[model samples]
Target: MALGLFWATVSLVVFLLISTADMLGYLKPKNHFDVDGKTVVVTGGSQGMGRALGKLLAQRGANVVIVARDRQKLEAALKYISAAAKDVEKQRFHYISADVTKSEENIRIVEEVTSWNNGNSPDVVWANAGGAYSELFIDTPVELMRSQMDLNYFAAAYLAHATLRSWLRPASTKQTSEAAAAVAPRHFIITSSVVCFVGLAGYSPYAPAKSALRSLADSLRSEVRLYNGYRRANPSKGPAADVEIHCVTPGTIFSPGLDNENKTKPAVTHILEESDPRQTEDEAATAAIKGLERGGYLITTQWLGSLLRAGMLGGVPRNAVFMDTMKAWLTPVIWLFMQPDLEGKVLRWGEKNEVKLPQ
Candidate 1:
């Protein structure tokens, strides 16, 4: 008992030291850019969280451009975003109607936006267009699975690739050196879901697609770092466009998409996923933007989402906070001990309910 007490005390002291250091900003990464007056592009900006982000960014003085497939929705979003602009004359909001799932369409949209900004590339691109449908993997058609992947995974990938390519263009282009000097750090944000980390029974089709997005975000983060490093080393040629990639893993959000998803979602899946408190679209957007401002690689809106992010760990980099990392490492052990109870809940739910396929 004495030996155990001694070890506990040592552990507590070590944790305190790490936590204090992290809180003192010794472990945090530098924020390379600010959003003020920057050109920001958001996909799926027709409604929900995308619309919220567009409005918020516009209000903060960003020249916001929103893209969506529905022209009417896009126009409506533009009006909402325009109303939120701090300076109507200086901060312009544009809306483009295009299907993000098509690679060619995404490329075209990026090119047009660049042209509209007078050859200036967007400083931030938020890939927020994705949908989810909860159904058993076996009951889901291949077409549905393919559609989900196309929308959730490939859309973000195509947008990121196109935007990065434009941002990394030769510095001798139309952008003046003065503009380059004031350039905000380029950012690519992908809207991945908490489902990416925790796969429930009915979300098999949707979860894998979100998981693919997480993988894409991870790869893009590493690649962007390397690209920025090379540009920095060869500064004589042009300015370095440092791009930061972030993945947002939001828990349940109160949005139109969620409402539609819940219609088809299974009861057992709801029991598992709906355990966390749901966030409004505006609240989620606010949290996501705050995370980006803090230069976080993995952003979560809720405590449950953050805990899941840390617990899953996988190949993603650790959060800048030392206490957060410690919590993440310890969560898996807690999860192991709680597995029986969790499984029992699922078993009981399964026994009481039946999942029916659509006719």
Candidate 2:
């Protein structure tokens, strides 16, 4: 009798979850990314996915600022992006040659962008300036780990810190609370990797940094609500607008960064990632943009990404709660069988080879 009752309760819960998710999914916005007439800042915008995003946003009618440390590539990106502008007269494009790894430089980026935007903060900021180094943890140098952390995690954190401080401030007395209420929400997007969810054999140095980015997004997503709640309480005296934090975990891409990582990627490491879906720069950016438009907090570009993310969803915000819950339920069962296969490969690789420690 107890077993039957427990089964009955489980069925009821599943029913309710599905019904709710269906209703919510149907109500989701079609194009919530809404960049038209907004000023956007994209780091790593000189090439690859960043440049594709900049160009796409331009086509959708955004005034874009692309930031990178390379003047030549940025300048080239500016022209490419500028030509794609939906409104030649109204939409503008510029490039900033600044290394985002420096905190002070990030602060200056915000200041310069604010100045360029006629004394207003950018409506969106995309942190895509990061790099990767692959090696067994034992073979990896402590110094390389520091560089990985700086490029992948701290760089994005520095920019985000500067952005939120400039954004989350006391509203100007000149602007009425009702006007602020009508303002659209702002977006902060960070780019992580699929490996962040599941650590691999050869990515000891890179995966943790990307994982940090995911963790930061999750924490900030919840914390930003405090200001938004204050806005709700004191509509006339709160923040300028609602803030949404999103993390985009893109799968492997055919890009220059990937090219660099491949030169050092271990053979067994490549075997571990053989199943990952591959997307071109434009494809990844386009899919990610669509996910953001649909109000996804943790966005993934492909099927494998979604599956990987489902297995690891802790307390993060949900894109489709019921679907995610169902996948989350099934992923562990799948992992039960898959984990051994992966472990066996790692074991065999270790038996056949040894990593030469960097002196």
Residue range 190-213, candidate 1, lDDT tens digits: 999998877677888899889989
- Candidate 2 ranges beyond 4 A from true positions: 1-30, 173-177, 354-359
Candidate 1 segments whose C-alpha is farther than 4 A from its true place = 1-14, 17-33, 173-183, 238-240, 354-359
Q: Go through the candidates in order and give each one's C-alpha lDDT.
A: 0.83, 0.89
The pairs that clash in candidate 2 are 177-236
lDDT of 2 by residue, 1-359 (tens): 99999999999897776767675665555777899999999999998889999999999999999999989999998999999999999997888889899999999999999999999899999999987898778877799999999999999999999999988887666356667667899898999989888978989999999999999999899899999898877876777888899999998988998899998888999988887689999999998998888889899998889988999988776787777887898899989988999999888987898846557
Error of 1 at 3 (Å): 14
Q: Evaluate model 2: give its lDDT.
A: 0.89
Clashes of each: 0, 1
